[model samples]
Target: MEDPSLYFPLPTIKTLLQTFYSSFLFCFLRVFPLCLALLFETLVLVHKWSFLGHLLFVSAVVLYTTLVYHFSRPAPVYLVDFACYKPPSHLQVPLHSFMEHSSRFGCFEKESVEFMGRVIKLSGQGERTSLPPALHYIPPRTGHLDSVEEAHMILFSVMEDLLAKTRVNPSEIDVLVVNCSGFCPSPSLSSMVMHRFKLRDNVKTFSLGGMGCGAGVIAVDVAQTLLKLCSGAQAVVLSTEIMSTGWYSGKERKKLMLNCLFRMGGSAALLQSGPQAARVAKYQLRHMVRTHMGASDRGYFSAMREEDSEGITGVSLERDLMQVAGEILRMNIGALGSRVLPLSEKFWYSFSLFHKRFLDPKTEIYVPNFKLVIHHFCIPPSGKALLRELGKGLRLKKVDLEPALMTLHRFGNQSSSSLWYELAYMEAKGRVKRGDRVWQLGTGSGPKCNSAIWECISPVNPLAKVGSDPAGPWFDCIDEYPIAMDDF
Candidate 1:
């Protein structure tokens, strides 16, 4: 079927225009009386009182109409329900080794090294020697049906779990959006999901691949769009990285980083505009900003590296990955500010900019402090340096970053799931209260960056906490944070 997002009226664009025009009209009318009074004075001085009265009547009518329209229009309310997210039981490979190895690449000072050693001592697990026999059995570099079968095994397990928790039937989902950065083949991931789940023929489905980490928010954006067109239509979103296909066989340090950092992870989410879901976690997806920086081979080469002479493909991040990431994050923030950022923040940022550019010629405006507006934060599993750079740039505190660090220590970088894990951590710790906001930032190939802002609703569900369900036993102890590679 045709992609649902292709046809829906984009509310983001519409809202942007609406806000711009409203602000423009307000300013235009506000200045009109002053301009008109000047004109009237000039006319009276020139002995043209009749013309002044005519202009005054016209301006008054226009100002009145603008005020009435502005006051009458109400703000839009988007209600997003969180369906249960369950990863396949089979794909659970704990991430101590991955976390240890990935963290090493970025500025491994004595403390971080000591921290890694502590994690190793705490987990008491050896380095990941090999994949399970089942995974290893798949012949190298050939995309086959077995890959799909394995993908299905991973997909269905999560789907079934979600269906059970939500009490939603497999056949009832009206829109299916699946985003898998790897292992995409003919018939697409969405079609495969639909076929495997036996979704109705009428269900609309879209498969988004090759979009890397930012795809999760891209999926959320697509779901938000689909929710608007069909009343009662529920959208199911699946985000996963197919490690089975992208496994790096080369011993290159860059290639090995992927092997070390990325693990098998997938998340299933259900979004619906229907009132039933409105009573749930109510994620009013206010804004999404997507910025793509790398179009040329040079720019693309900056973010993505594939280390095979035999044409095998996998992401090999360069040493300066975080530097590229910070640039993209800044670009995305600039685009998003016009839409999602509060006027208070805009005023502060703009004031700083004016002060730096015009008044203080020598000083550059510091990036506006995002810590105050940020309710919770999630950064990807690039490394400690990346996290530290982001914190320093954004002026985030230890408490602001601790939940994310804790999640990475426990879960490794589950790619797209990393943000969800961080969110889960906050919920577990009871840091996310009613009316709190969350900023989810993502980075990926195409040298891209994307962000989504979620405002908390009235209720924070306890059941959504990680390690609280039947899967709790799989997680290691939560008391002392996992400290990998500390030489005590």
Candidate 2:
């Protein structure tokens, strides 16, 4: 069978008719009022009304039009600030230490030990990447208590930093969203955050689990939706992956990839919707597009949690993961391009699609130049190979991929929070300027691809001092970045 993803979904006759009808109705409503105003003005002119009367009438019309336009539009959402957790240097596990620790565990076979070592060395992760304190112990303490401790350390630290920087009281937070792909406790992470900060009882709370690395953007999408409903509300999203309980003890190489790739980290961001917040916010949300291919068997099983022959449970990474990721990414960007791409690019892309489908089956489809609309990119820093594939597919230059590559080397794959770390790297380097548009692309299990666009509304200086804490996550090492890819 031909690939279903090869063709984009076309608008049906019903959809076209709905669009036409909406457009006609909107135009008629707008024009009818203007025609009435014109008629009233003509009557006033013919009747020789007083100048003051005419001025009052025109002012009333203008005022009414402004109010209608203002109330009709949805409130804008703003990203006030964000913070990424920087674990203590004591938690840093060098490659040799990590290998030694793994070998110390008698559960792994010799070949599995060697496989993990090779994966780590070529994984584009540096020696300074951190692991949880529990993992540092001999024989490793992988249990419920240890997982909760790790979660507390990461989630609370990032939340504290974000709250301090934004100075927004917990009582004022109208919504709280906490996402951890692998771990979900009894009370929920969102409830834990609320209790820790003593937030309002009525605060809207949501805890998302099993959504994989893309859940960060998914959580932000959820917050944005809620903010629209509650006018002038503030929301906070916390993203992280708890790996203490997620360690794979089995010999399955596919399951072991997660052990090598994921590291300890978390991020918290504050988003608010209102005119007042926009004045002080860093970025204004522009567009968000999410694509899911879970309906297909290959996509659904691409990455899944299951047991080995020994019944040792772990998340498996199928060999075809990259293929599935590429397909989902293509569909996601195609949807996003329709909304953000200029008319010229859209026209050529549509023409190429038509030609390829009808005129010449051999013709290749055109890839829209996203760089035309986006100034910076923060794609998932999952691994070097995936990053390289995405860079090539998107036609991104080395400079454009610098943030992701460097973030991977310095912090490893933080799962949902990896994209935020990449964004932080860019800010710490003083690269993000006012009016620059940033695109954050995230992909994960469920074979999902999500994209978020942010327009910098105000200047973002290098985070030299985050509320007198000395510096941001990358402040100490920002100057040393843009390292040669060959070094990894």
Candidate 3:
């Protein structure tokens, strides 16, 4: 009889050598353990030879490195040799029937009423037979080709507009980055851009899909990183949310909110490694704080809600999401504290530490005195309640959420492009001046909260004014100060 262990016997030297012909496998097997051992030894030596000390030391090093990296990170000041295009505002769904027609595909059953209410509210008190055409989507008759085809079409349309605006030869673009939240298929967005535009064979391209509303910022981060690697590459980034190819969780009110909120929107931004770009909304990327609280799997499951059973449909955010959102904020606060908080706050905490442990030895109190630095705020149009909750959680002032609420009311949640819209609103109002810092926060169903901070480097673009219209200049539009939910 064969020994039980023989059924899973290890390979002999010759067998191992034969199998190790796969270079990648051989390299990992041969090198990874050695590297790990050396790292472990180095870490041990750096500490007092205690496991806990090693862990603390390594964590401190990582934290310090990240802080220094951010502090020393080059602030990008580039002109947006870019143009925004809305496919004939007539494409906008009318307030009376936009949701009725779009939600018939079994996705809008629960929150259709809520969505319709927002649409009507945004249209204003006066009823007009012909409102300006909304940039809208052709509702997907089926979800299969919804995102893939639509993403391609949206990017193509935007690229043509950008190319026309910049008058730059399509071939001159050294790099391309495209991001779509719901639509990613064969020939990823980057490759498709290369093939569609016929760029040089080795043109650098990147496709970021499924990053959700925060993807616009994430794409900016990607472009920022890529720009660091190339000396003279021009990068174009496209962001959109394809509503047509969406999967909806059947009738779940929590899930249906997206159908009511998200609409057709896309923006194409061009970036170059040059200081001249400071004229446009100077792309002075400031601190980017990303925190993943995913280790709390229970917390993850709590916020998990799939628009489709197979997890391939439209994204449905859960209702109990505030709980997860709170956790995410905690993680981000810890991750970003070092970068955003002044040394005074840290010193105060340290003093409190000594006071509690050795001096008073009775209680512990650690309060971080952080001054609010958000000059402009852009948050997801999850809901009025959600916005309110965020304000309370973050201790945000009423003025902070005003722009966000106004945009949500007017645009009905333009998905990833909403922040850009808010940015436009701020510029229109002249709230964003040189050196002002703005924070954009995005929330999605992964119960994800992503934040990006941009520091102004130059004056706002007078010609390319954001959200400017006959209604009024940006400031005039905001005359009704301290916007609140009741106004909407």
> Per-prediction RMSD in angstroms?
8.8, 9.9, 13.5
| Runs in model 1 lying further than 4 Å from the true structure | 1-146, 274-276, 305-307, 358-362, 464-488
- Highest-lDDT candidate: 2
Q: Write the per-residue lDDT of candidate 1 for residues 342-404, one digit (tens) a residue.
A: 788888788888998889977766566565666888777555556766788777876777765
lDDT of 2 by residue, 43-156 (tens): 889999889868967986897688556655566899999989998899998999989889988889889989999998887899899999998987888899999999999898
Q: How high is the lDDT of residue 472 in model 3?
A: 21
Quote each prediction's TM-score.
Answer: 0.71, 0.88, 0.68
**Predicted model with the maximum TM-score:** 2
Tens-digit lDDT string for candidate 3 (143-201): 55545656666677777767765566667676687877666777787887788888766
Which residue pairs overlap in candidate 2's backbone?
none
Candidate 1 has what TM-score?
A: 0.71
Give lDDT per model, in order. Answer: 0.63, 0.88, 0.60
